[model samples]
Target chain A: MAESYRRSRWSNALFVAPYLVVFFALLVFPLFWGMWLSLNKVDLFGGGQFIGLRNYARVLSDPVFHQAVRNTVVFVAVSVPTLVGLGLFLALALNKTTRGSSFLRGLYFSSSILSVTIVTLIWRIVFIPNDGLMALIFNVLGLEPIGFLSTKGWSLFSVGVATVWWCIGLPMMLLLAALQQIPADLYEAAALDNAGKWRVLTRITLPSIKPTIMLVAVIQIVMQFQLFGQALIMTNGGPAGSSRPIVMYIYETAFIRWDVGMGAAASELLFVIILCAAMFQYWISSRKEVA
Target chain B: MADRSAFSPENLTANRTLFWIAAVLAALMLAPVLWILGLSLKNNQDLMHGTDAVFRAPYTLKNYADILVNSQVFGWFLNSLIVATGQTLGVLTLCSLAGYAFARLEFPFRRAIFIIVLFGLAVPEQAVIIARHQMFNWVGLHNTHIALMLPGMSSAFGVFLMTQFFNAIPKEIDEAAMLDNTSQFRIFWKVLLPLTLPAQATLGIFTFLLAWNDYWWPLISATKKEMYTLTIGIASTQTNFAQSEGLGFLSAQAIFASLPVVIVYIFFQRHIVTAVSGGAVK
Candidate 1:
């Protein structure tokens, strides 16, 4: 029996071996490499000398990096709250509606299936000037065409709108599922006490879905901070660098300028931001549960 | 349940208003997609003429004809199919083994390994693209579909998701198989594997979508135009055919590119709904 148990233990290790190899090689190695690279002045084709904290200091002093940081903050500021609030609102609205609710839910969630590429492509055409769909709509409504993708002031906002639209589906679906999990008897009980829809929503539904909401918020914030494709494709961080998010900056630094070291530094900065946000969220959510 | 007599007439009116509002919002969400479809069906002249002529213009299959006959889109579609399907199979097979191990087997540093895998979920793919490219180049796998299929084959999300699903399966089944003198590998294949259909489907769909829509890696790795995926193909179509009356053709190509995934979704919408909702349960 002990021999069999020992054999089983060895089998278990063998079963998990492939995953451990790949995980360490692909994910963990690059992560630690990135951390190391951030601290050194590494080149693509040559030997790198260790330069402690210089890359981080350079990133801090760089104007383009500063711009990317500011742009990312604005994006998170605008996009995260909208995504969370709109997701919740839509979830609540769909939850209340009994007619064709499932069908509508499916339709709303279908947008999420279209990869970020497709979403960006569709919106790129939609936001094009004069001959574009948005322009056509504006023409019909006697409103001037808005250069959503071109103007510096509105470029990030336009990308934010598209990003929100692309991502809102996931949270909406999650929140809807959470909302459905709430016991109907609680609502019925509240109704027995003459509670109105708004009152019941405030008293029962909000509190019930709070955990899911917090989860969605953290996930959305992390995702928004890594905003890349839309800026890369739709705006190209153009019209005076207004829409250049951190990931785009990282991409440009690594691939375009061949500054792999600087890009690694930028990515490290992003990792720190994401790690902090995630830890704070974990703390907040756990605290709420304890309370 | 409350009696109908308990609610006021004003409450009924308000409820009706709210219901309509939700319905309207749902319709509005679908408007852009409908308009894109409409625009694809119109000719160059009609599209150039703008929204007034959007519905009034004579619908034509000319754009579709042009794309089908003139472009490399069909080739890109085939390429996407090869990559997506290969990556999906790879991820499913690898993740199932890993997930099963993590779920049922007790090994040294299991929790540490699981935490490492979970951390990959937070690290966006873009963060590692530079290092990935360097590795691919070092291995001389650059510019190959294998390069695309390699990184995605061992997904952290897949392992995490499948682990959750496998954990829910009772251990008694495995014990019963063991008592019957079945090997552990055979049990995984013959006993536990068949029962993980829903989880497998979920992983398949998610993996397929990720592989299908990947643009950056393909863009970086694939230097040749023939090697371009659908996303890069469409972007280049605009630039390459800039002077030609190709907007309509571009739209047609876009629609064609989008069709496979749309058809897949339509057929498997229920599975997708279950899978996405299941993800949140993680």
Candidate 2:
């Protein structure tokens, strides 16, 4: 019996071994390795002198890095509210058992399934100056075409618009699910008390879905903070590097310029921001059970 | 409460208003896609002059024909297929086994290992990507399908989801098999594993979509055009002014590249919705 128990323990270890190997080698080990890489003066070639915190300091001071940080913040700031608010709004509007609601839900969520390349491509044509869709609308309205991808703030805003269109599906779906989870009796009770639609929405609907709202916000923040592909393909982080986010900066630093140490430091900074958002998400999810 | 009755005229008007508003918003959501489709049918010359012509006639299939004739596009599609499918299978196997172990098996340091794996949830890809790229470079694994598929397989989310799923299954089912003197691996293989098919479908679809849509890692690792996945390959094919000079072709490629995911969305809409919402809620 003892021998069989020991053998079973070993067999169980076999079940976990493959995943542990991948988990350690790729996820865990790379984190510490990246930290070490950030501390040294490293590159693609054989150059590794212990540089201490200089890379961090340099990255913190670089104008381009500063711009990337600002741009990333602007993106997260703009898109998170838009995605969360619009998602909740749509969820409320469509939460009813109305005709064609499911089809509309699927229609809204379809863009989220597309790749960033496809999303960006579709938006680029729409945002093109003079002859694109938005420009055509502007022409009909007798307004001048704005250089969405060429101007500075407008460039990043254009990326944000594309991102909202591509990403609104997620928060909408999540919020709609959360809405469905709210017991029907709550609304019935409110109606019995002669509550108005606005009153019921605020007192019952908003409070009921607050946890999901936070979850959506945190998820959007984490995702939007890692703004890489959209900014990369749409504006190419152009108009004098006004729209480049932190991930783009990290990619350019590490891959394009071969500044491994600086890139690692920049990446670490990005991880800190994302980690905070993720932690907030975990916190809300953990508290969700109690709430 | 405005009568608070489903059949009331006030409520009827409100519901109609909401439906109309939703319909308009849905149209706004769909216009870009339809416009792209329209542009894809129009000649590049006609579009270069003005996209307004897309609303008119004289559409052609030449752009799609060009894409179909481009063997490189198919090569990239095949590469994406291999990578996405390989990543999905690997993640399913590794995560299911580990999830089973964490959920049921007795082992030394199991809790510690599980905690470590959970911690991986917070570590963003950007943090490890530089070191990972360099490690792959040192080992000369860059531009390989294995490298493309391996990192994604280290999915903490998969392990977490599968573990929760396994834990939900009552132990009595497996215990009965154990009473028959069946080996533990067989119990997991023949008995418990089959029960987790729904979970597997969810995780598999999520992982497949993620792998298909992944861009950053493949962009760096698969620098060689031959090794590039469809996302990277399609993006690379876009010239500086392809939107103007080759507008129809560009639209065609975007539409083509998105077809697989669109098909998956159409087929697995329920599973995809449940996975997205349930994954977050749980």
Best model per TM-score = 2
Where model 2 places Cα greater than 4 Å from the true spot, the runs are A1-8, B1-15, B278-282
Lowest-scoring 10 consecutive residues by lDDT in candidate 1 chain B?
B5-14
lDDT per residue for candidate 2 within B196-250, as digits (tens), equals 9989999899899999999999999999989999999988876585357788888
RMSD of each: 3.1, 2.8
Candidate 2 residue lDDT tens string, A141-185? 999989899997799999998999999888988987787777766
Worst 10 residues of 2 chain B by lDDT: B6-15
Residue A100 of candidate 1: its Cα lDDT? Answer: 67
| Model 1 lDDT tens row, B1-56 | 55753343223222555556767977877776776677778887755545446668
Query: Evaluated with DockQ, which candidate comes out highest?
Result: 2
In terms of TM-score, how similar is model 1 to the real structure?
Answer: 0.93
Instruction: Give the per-residue lDDT digits (tens) of candidate 1, residues A1-291.
Output: 323633436558787788778777777777777777777776767367898899888888999999999999999988988988988877766664444666776777778788666787777767777766787788889999988888978899889878877887788888877876776667656767877777777777788879888888988888889899888888889788989999899888887887778788888888889988878777876876785
Q: List the residue pairs that clash in candidate 1.
A: none
Off by over 4 Å in 1: A1-8, A44-46, A96-99, A284-291, B1-15, B49-51, B240-245
True contacts kept of each: 0.30, 0.63
DockQ of 1: 0.40
